[model samples]
Target: MSNTQGPVLVIGATGRQGFATATSLLEKGWPVRAFVRDPAAPKARELRSAGAELAVGDLDDEDSLRPAMEGVHGIFLMLTMMEGVHITAKGIADEERRGKTVAELAAKAGVAHLVYTSLQGVHQDSGVEYYDAKEHIEDHIRALGLPATILRPVLFMDNFATYNRPTRDGDNLVLALAVLPHLPMPLIAIQDIGRFAALAFERPAEFLGRDLVIAGDLLTPPQIAEILARTAGLTPRSVQVPVEQISAFDEQVGKMFAFFNSRPTPPIDITALRTTLPDLMTLEDWLRATDWQA
Candidate 1:
């Protein structure tokens, strides 16, 4: 079969990173199989319109995943954590179960490569449910001896446009979050991640069995505020709330901020990733390019 004839099975293909990866693969002349919950959903239809073959399957069902993996050349795996929802014990268990199921099935199906998207700075005793669950899944994938490349992404630039974007207070752009304004945080565009995943599959000799922490830019909260302010024609103000206040809202998210705040500087060398994936966006560049109303 030609490299373009692949059956690259992209789990979570309806969502952000998965969609980006699937789109990138298509752009690179590779056939993509998108495994999604509801093929009738609009986003799934969008994938189909974009030329990805749809495979209806639930992440929680290993049996469903089996058929989806048939004749697959590669796999893009991610756990579907409910963003902005309160993390419950059951949610954490479900994430682990679903993530581990995908990993095991990929191995059983003899997938050539499995790309797992996980969080950066995962610690075993991090006391954060989501991050630790990813760590557990990573350990399991490693234990299975599957040829895997783990992509650890930082804070997404998309969050600035959607979930955590700046709010306008009078003439000022107010960014209210849990961490200090000066804490350097790594960030990336989902498209960049997709590009890297596609390149990894194409160059398996260089990427297989690697754990690459990928980011496009590193900027602090206040720096981000200034960029948005510059782009949107407003004064910038940052409200770094107490961890407790954030915890009252979201314990998991609050702990994540505490982790970010405690670490003065982001440890990831984004430059290290530029060799393979270049033209990363800065905060100013991203804000200028985005349409807030969209």
Candidate 2:
């Protein structure tokens, strides 16, 4: 490791955000240690191939994190909700506990800086159990007395490629939510979240104690449909998916849309963010870059 680039531990390294963050740091010439549940997993093997040191650990056991945290330059803490999209009360509790444990462990380990990837623009409760858990963890991290940067990312464009696929084959992708196509919800590429995380660690003085709301471009469902049409070469329709099918996940997402609909838009200044991370991805940029499969 270079003198400036010490070991940085990345929590949830096997997952989307964590893996991207770790990869970003590695590309920046930082020695990266990936903290994952099973170091032998395929993604873990890939992380190792990409020049990240593997540290086996789980959020449920903070002691497992101690070795990963020991004498680290910084820590990228991306804690999972511990289960599916439809979060429960127990799931919320687990997330909060796990995040707090990471913060406490990082503080105890005497880590230089800690960056937490959190959600943005959520009101009290926000009708989403997971968002509430993130809010709690954010508060806990702030109170930890550790030098920390809280990067609050809006909706991830990666969701479109992964869980929120617009069309299956040639079928019109219908999305059911409380808000209409015109209602703007801040969105970013999950890869951009990683890019921002790396930059935050690199420049602690500017980012420390700051809550950055990150967004690449503001687009609604209909607008997103256009992107899908352009990419997929098929006209996509925007109808709300059935709420009854997904239950709380749908209800919570509906509330999120409603919250976005009623409130002033979040200040995720793209122009300002571009000064540091000039390559921060826009929706079009993401669409062009992604190899969208049917």
Write the residue-wise lDDT of candidate 1 on 47-136 in tens digits. Answer: 899889999978767778899999999999877567446776678788898889888888999998999999887753566788888999
lDDT measured at residue 220 in model 2 versus the true structure, 0 to 100: 76
lDDT (CA) for every model shown?
A: 0.82, 0.79
Error of 1 at 275 (Å): 2.3
TM-score of each: 0.94, 0.90
TM-score of 2: 0.90
1-294, model 2: which lDDT tens digit per residue?
A: 232646889998999999899988889888899998898899899989999999987778767888778878999988766557654567778888989988888888778889999888644446666788899888888788889999988888888876776654455544333445676767899999999998888878789888888988887778777777677667667765444444545555555666656664755678888787889888888887887654
Highest-lDDT candidate:
1
Listed per model in order, the count of residue pairs whose N, CA or C atoms clash below 3 Å is 0, 5
Hey, what RMSD does candidate 1 come out at?
A: 2.0
Model 1 residue 102 CA deviation in Å: 1.1
Clash pairs, candidate 1, are none
